[model samples]
Target chain A: MSENMGNKVSLELYRTQLLARYFEQRASDLFLENLVKGTNHLALGQEAVAAGFGVAMNKSDYTYCTYRGHTHTLVRGAPVAPMLGELMGRECGILGGKGGSMHLTSVEHGAMGSYAIIGAQLCIALGSAWSAQYLGTDQVTTVFFGDGTTNIGTFHEALNMAAVWKLPVVFVCENNLYMEYTPIGKVTAVEHPGADRASAYGLDSIIVDGNDADAVYHAAQDAYARARAGDGPSLIECKTYRHQGHSRADPGKYRPKEEVEAWFARDPISMYRLRMMENGFTDEDLTEMETEIQNTIDEATEVAKLSPVPSLDIIDKDVWADGGSAWRN
Target chain B: MAQLTYREAVAEGIAQEMRRDNNVVFLGEDIAAAGGVFKATVGLFEEFGEKRVIDTPISENAILGAAMGAAMTGLKPIAEIMFSDFLAVCWDMVVNEIAKARYMTNGQVKVPLVIRTANGGGSRFGAQHSQSVENWAMAVPGIKVVAPSNPSDVKGLLAAAIRDPDPVLFFEHKSLYAMKGEVPNGEHVLELGKASVLRQGDDATIVALAAMVPRAVKAAEILATKGIEVTVVDVRSLVPLDTQTILAETVKTGRLFTVEENPRLCGWGSEISSIVTEECFYDLDAPVIRITTPHVPLPSSDNLEDATIPTVERIVETILKNMG
Candidate 1:
């Protein structure tokens, strides 16, 4: 299928992708230079996705994503300074420096949380969607997870429950084709992943070229609409790839060099940039956008670096909400 | 005040909270039409309907995860796990997700979910249905565990757990469902982490939990005839333990005995024993004795099952043995 689904692709969407790309790029530099001070998995090649679905939902709509969440959060309007500050373990971070890269959560931005436990984020997203319906709110929640999560028990449990209850949720499988350096083909039996599995739950599912921001936005819009209309849950599997390795430490040497090169050539950022140029955007216009994003990220990084590390006294705090605790000892 | 069974009290507790707070809802397998296998949720389905009293598919893990998710949002979800043995199947959801959310989020979110599960033996349902999971609940952090012995405590704690700003594990003994006691009419919300001293004595302090509370009470009656005075303390809440109440009683008595239905090794008694020993080490006149079942799975046979659970006879005998 062509990247465009007959709808006019917005330049604003392209700008969102650019912002996500720049954010991930800066994070990469920070992680590589050891300035971020934590292990992280950067969503390098997956810029279109982070921006596509991020901007597709309304402000009241919630999101639940995997550990590679900075790009998703940035595109969803989470403040860069606080997010980066969180990465640096500063008190000014989004979670007050408690949740680092893998566990970022923003209630203001409707980001429920990012989880390191494989399929947990997706499962929790169903709960939020159930809450929306239970409380008579039309707000929908989009659960983003790697295709690798589809094989897990939580995926089946969540999808089954969402289908039965008619939860306002859109399950987005960002199939990056790998699960921690292992090919999905080796680990998974199903070729279509979420698309194939969703049928078992009597859910409508679609496959999208995840590199195309317009395609994801359109798919997400349809799911969100059906959800808001009380039509129950659906699945959208986006075929994408992560540009970075599984984590900061690994070089992803297991992947064939040719495969990496092929994916690198079709980098979502460059493709979107090319599409913009063809659509009457100038080199100077692109440069201005890039420079502006760079400068903003630079200031954010500096602020994150300067922010004070979280106090150790708060280490024992927040265990319970009623000033009671289970882990005090 | 009205006399009601333990199951009736629990059902009333849920119903009263649902009436008071629109945010409170119920979800469990067969809890709607069947009124729960143990009938702990009887009449709630018709009173609350499908939205409030939801009958979920038989998925324990999903129930726990979804409840946490709902609690993090606006709804105060009371999820019924049916049996406490199934709790081990979804232990990750309890220990990892429910227990760690608020702390990991730096207090940004609170999971006010009440996980109600049938616990303990004596109904002859075999090992799976017969488990006292206070040890499991108390072992986890960021979770409040409540196992009320009588009808009154169940009613008050159920309402309290729904209103609590944290997650709670409400363990219900299978045998105690039909057990009757006087329950106060209308909004009765008990404070979590407060112990109820059922019987007052000065010779020794007996900290009893869940089903063991009633057993300890019976044991106190039996011990009184032998010229031995025993104080039976019902430890209503395990996680947010009322250490002050327990400590004061232990200091007054100078001898303490922890009673639970769980295994002796790494059970809730060990934690209580540690607390009393650490706090009242000098006040101790005798070695703190823990009365618990042997570390073994509950058997299916009537005679076998009887040998595993803590009983009044066992409590009385253990108290007598410890006194010397």
Candidate 2:
């Protein structure tokens, strides 16, 4: 736990982390039951990183993330029903099921969009930050991606431009040790994929304990303050691990058993729960929050199940602003 | 009315929008102080100042991605990709990100930005720097593609693209930048998806875009002396295509000839031919002939480049042969 974080903020972080954890667990179960179609990238063990940034960020600040962004979207205050419904391909989904699991977006809540392509949102997020800076607004833009994205070209392009322009943006790299099936270290030259490259872009190398919510919150707060104060962009590398596979299809058999168990012992949700208790939170207080989160997830799942599938009539709609895909007029 | 070069109109068009709306900002490499590599965007930096008219590093992906982000937020940005051929460097941003952002989000986001690139061949800059790629933007579902033939259309269409609610790719022909024509005094915004009939005739209809439009018109003039008066239709915008004007002219003349600067295979003319065949199949007096450059990379040598692209003589000869 950090000294700067108040008890109330810590509890809120704990609650958000619990919400993300429970929601993803239900989402996984729904995927197994065939209620969720296509493929989904779950963020089961990376709750602290999402919760930390989510709680610390201002409501107006924009967020961009990769395909594994369910937790990021939830932390931005998007209702779980539409998010799960989107995964279920229902009309009531956030994007009306037009953007499947990989492309979740809720612009109204400042959760810009989850890009399926690696390192794409990195460049896209620059525009939002540029908009803020150009308009003279204090709104900061934060973009999150996995460790694998550090090798992509856009990562370098975006970082260079952001620094040159001195745009108010923060780049967060959630290094979950694995990029899809391959270990990130195998392909990457540097030990810290994101942090190691920060000096080249003239940015500070910020490394955080992503498993600890307080540590993440402090890091996020510092980055946001620097961005708001016109200090350009900051790259923070968070060391975390994902409990599940890259997607629903793989079982992640490539990883050794000992590594999985060791990561499991330092589970973000369990660690946060213990931290809350150490901060004078009663067992009843924590249990009550957990029960509430479970009920919320249960209700969200039911709502998603009841939501109807999108109709074929809208197949050609929304292609243009006029609500029709008419190329020749 | 004022006579302006196509390159000067590029600057005027952007300056007009920036003057009207504070949200309108422009960015690209050497665009601000240097006034663009082609010198087409001259005076934008001086008039709008450094904040509104910014310069960027040579990062196509970042340029377009940042434009998309700015457009979605509040600012209406105009990003220059230097050359249309360089769009390949940022194809993912244009095709996967900018083009699909609106539809993928179910219209929750609106990317109202313009990507201005110097397109087409004529300067003999070689295949890498001189390929015509309007068809690339046209194939994308959400993007609006506009290619103007003359200075007046450049100002009008560029202004219209800036005001459009969707992402627009404004293709300024590298060959026509030096050409001069009369433009309206102020705020000349033309509607997209509308073709301009440069010359009217009943014998035959010649359709062209960008650099080909002037060549097609010259071909019509030469054919007029030979008593073969053909209607010249300048396809100003490709996406949201003016099919009605194209079909009407084709049906009126009972013949259609497309002068395309792009390569032979799967060019914009192919789509026009298919549409005409489906709609005006019976109205045609002869098969639709497309006067196109052969499928090959544009060479740097002036002789090879001129021979590669469809010339005024080629259009005239092709039409004269096809009329028989």
Q: Which candidate is the best by TM-score?
A: 2
Task: Give candidate 1's error at residue B44 in angstroms.
Answer: 0.8
Which ranges in model 1 have alpha carbons more than 4 Å from their true place? Answer: A1-9, A323-329
Candidate 2 regions with alpha-carbon error over 4 angstroms:
A1-5
Candidate 1, residues B33-149: lDDT per residue as tens digits? 899988888999998898889888887878888888888888899999988999987887898888888888888777889999898988888778787878888878888899999
Model 2 share of native interface contacts: 0.82
The global C-alpha lDDT for each of the candidates, from Candidate 1 onward, is 0.85, 0.93
DockQ agreement of candidate 1 with the native complex: 0.61
What are the per-model DockQ values? Answer: 0.61, 0.87
Residue pairs clashing, model 2: none
Q: How accurate locally is residue B56 in candidate 2, as Cα lDDT from 0 to 100?
A: 91
Q: Which candidate number would show the highest lDDT if scored against the true structure?
A: 2
Q: Pick out the ten consecutive residues of candidate 2 chain B with the lowest summed lDDT.
A: B41-50
- In model 1, the clashing pairs are none
Clashes of 1: 0
